[model samples]
Target: MVQTTATRLKNRLRRTDGQLQGILKMVDEGRDCQDILTQLAAVRSSVERIMGVVVAENVKRCITDDQLDTDQQAQLEAALELVVKNH
Candidate 1:
């Protein structure tokens, strides 16, 4: 079965949550700082990936949506440009 974007994002978020829990456990157990930092990096990357997915989906929507007025389309394009530049 093909998973929708929402489903994919939810799964990614769950994995990120699990990574965070593991980091907490590592801290409690006095695990190596390097190991904890590695996990933290992984979680950060996961979150970034989620953000990219969301932005890509929104961009696609903006391009394909035909009902948007000219002003709304311009606003969305500007907002998307800002997000891309900041990201």
Candidate 2:
């Protein structure tokens, strides 16, 4: 199960990487600035979503491990908040 989750996350990151490359190519081709910006925004959102998912998974693991103290939970929550706000 852990291996599956890692694989899925890796796939998500790879797809996001492709989108990033697409944005770079669009810029190189002198595509419409507005269109490029829109696509870039999408890429940013996709990365942010992936980050949120990874953070959630980490939080779940921490809780299950019984080793995550209050400070650790607070830190994770803060990280989650940052991702949510940025996304």
Candidate 3:
């Protein structure tokens, strides 16, 4: 993975982790349902963004990596399929 992508993913993951902890605390403290749901939505969005980055990085590698041979095109296709199917 590219350094910038890795850093972005890590930062987003950390934010989501904090959001998850906050959600747990809210549940334990009996906070408002709407507030908790909002936070949870934020976490979901963060996770989706990270997933996008992962797929993008893989796609970039598939396009630019000189290490892959002609025979490895199938492998690249499979990887792309995984990313697309998941989405």
Candidate 4:
């Protein structure tokens, strides 16, 4: 079965949540600092990728939407730019 974008993103989020839980367990078990940092980095990368996908999808939708007036389109583009820049 084909997965929708939302489904794929949700799965990614679930995996990220699992990674966070693992990190917490690692902390409780006194795992090495470097190992924890590596896991943290992986989580960060995953989240960034999710964010990119979401932003790209939104931009694609906005660009293709025929009902949006010029002002609305500009606003959406600006908002997307802010999200990308802040991330």
- Which parts of model 2 are misplaced by more than 4 Å? 1-3, 65-87
lDDT of candidate 2 over 28-63, digit per residue (tens): 999999999899888888888887777777766767
Model 4: lDDT equals 0.87
Task: Quote the positional error of residue 24 for candidate 3 in Å.
Answer: 0.7
Q: Rate the local accuracy (lDDT) of all candidates.
A: 0.84, 0.80, 0.79, 0.87
Encode model 3's per-residue lDDT on 16-78: one tens digit a residue.
899999999999999999999899888877787678668867776758657678668678767
Q: Which lDDT tens digits does candidate 4 get at residues 1-87?
A: 999989999999999999999999999999999999999999998898789779867776757668788898788777776675455
**Off by more than 4 A, model 4:** 65-87
Extract clashing residue pairs from model 2.
none
Two-way lDDT contest, 1 vs 4, winner: 4
Q: After superposition, how far is residue 86 of candidate 2 from its true place, in Å?
A: 9.6
Itemize residue pairs with steric clashes in candidate 1: none
Range of the 10 consecutive residues with the lowest summed lDDT in candidate 1: 78-87
